[model samples]
Target: MKTLLLSLKDVEQALSMEEVISAVEQGYISYNEGKVQQPDIVSMEMPENNGETDIKSCYNKLNESISVKIASGFYDNGKNNELPTMIGTILLFDGRNGAPLCIMDGSLITGIRTGAAGAISSKLLARKDSKVVAVFGAGGQARMQIYALCQVMNIQEIRVYSEYTEELPKYKEYVERNTKVKVIICDTPEQAMKDADIAISTTPSKKYLVDKSLVKPGTHIVAVGADMAGKNEWDPEIFKGAKIVNDSIAQCISRGETRNAIISGIIKESDIYAEIGELLLGNKPLRESDDEITIFDTTGMGIQDNVTAAQVYEIAKKKGLGKYFEFI
Candidate 1:
């Protein structure tokens, strides 16, 4: 069997934010319609190594292939070794005969799909008139989150917050150079979140960074950093008397932002309003009113990886983008 090897550059060439957002939305729809077979995320934590790796896989009935993605984050890599903090890979196989189709770099895919998921959630949950956006991290994911939101909303101002004071200026320059959106660097998380129509937390913080006092009533929060148990971005009290939705209930309850809330008994499992899939399938409403606080917890999903990897493979194959060789 022949297998294609796609590099990070090749993956970047094959995928676009506009195309990815639509594909991700359809992935959610597929999950809602019971057309995807996905398993819970399996993870290994190595505190000694200052890193963690997660494995997720899925099979979409409408697609001809199945995919498994392995992603890792070594937080100290940037400071210790001058390497990127995160890296990932994806393997796609033919579903029928289980032929190895391709192995591709998944770092960009992971970030883009995550950003796309936020965009999808924002469209379905955020108020139609939402314009201002606050991003709580000055990293790649934060940049992509803003870019993805711009595709679906008319964003006029962007507020960025980061504990790394030096990184914030660089991030602001990057945003200004790439997009027309007005970028502002805030000194504190509360300053960044104030009066924001939409807020996204992309920092990897073990403790809560956003408090309920700073969040406005009509704001929509996209909690992205808490993809593992014991990781969180906001206080459990934020979920009190608010609408909560998850990308996957089982995954979110165990790993996402809701994990802390659930474990603390601040919120019950039955308190979940609905899944994003249900919203896409029209089984549940998006936002009940403009005054309601809505939060979407995304723990990352195998099905997202599956659909995204499949799309990249097809595009690369058609464009003759990646290196192909016999692997089996």
Candidate 2:
């Protein structure tokens, strides 16, 4: 019995924001160097419940990330207090032997990794002295995005916004308590973005939550909500004024949120300055001036999951956190 396994708690305990950011940067660099392998996401639309729907993202990447997410949303808020409106798990495998390694909680991994991607983007794109951070959608990812920003930036105050009125106070209390950063729940996304150096979006709506006019001269925006096809968070003017950086051009065009901009005559695919890899590898510039606006469309690629999961697995194995079993 190759008796060592890892759980979600184990992975969470072993990983830090800085570590996650480093791994995400490495994943980006790997792509730029042509050393990483990725595939288009294959998914299925699950049947509905009380007129609500869910989706399953099935992915495989060199045995490191072989998992599916079953995510559903039900908005009968007044009725049963719908659970999270999202739920999923990960099934990690031994890439070398094609054997089971661990079945861990993917929620925190997904949340932290997503937030770390935002942090990395902000680090590369935003003004270094940025102090005011605006976050649209006061939800799970919003919490982490701001947390990472607080960890990395000089943010003295955080402004938050969400469409759901009921969740604002809860989000407000939680952020200020955990981050120890003064938090303000703004009434609108536009209000939140005003004079802010960085803005992050974490909603799944099919519309734009940010305004091009609200952002000042030098602002970095990390759009993480629209990771799928047909979802958008900004107009072309936002990308037009900023250096548009993508996680991956092909995926962004085919299914990511950037696809909408490309399709709507708002932006040309050629307008993209570079992928995150180019910056991570010193092949391209990230931030040039104090007045430049930068946009990062973070439709996550597979390599992120592969590398992060691999890191968690390695650390957990050394720490002896879980039990290994024979599942060949």
Question: Could you tell me every candidate's TM-score relative to the true structure?
Answer: 0.98, 0.88
Cα lDDT tens digits for candidate 2, 1-328: 3534555567778688888888888878877877665656654443345323323332344334443433333444336775555454656655556565666556677788778888888888888888888887877888989887776777788888888877789888998898888888888777788778888888877777776678778888888887777667776567775788888887778766678777888789888888988888888877999998888888777667666767777778787776777655
C-alpha lDDT of all candidate models, in order: 0.91, 0.73
Residue-level lDDT tens digits of model 1 in 217-251? 88999999999998989989989888999999999
**CA displacement after TM-score superposition, residue 307 of candidate 2 (Å):** 1.5
| Model 1 misplaced stretches (Cα beyond 4 Å) | none
Worst 10 residues of 2 by lDDT: 50-59
lDDT value, candidate 1, whole model: 0.91
Overlapping backbone residue pairs in candidate 2 total 0
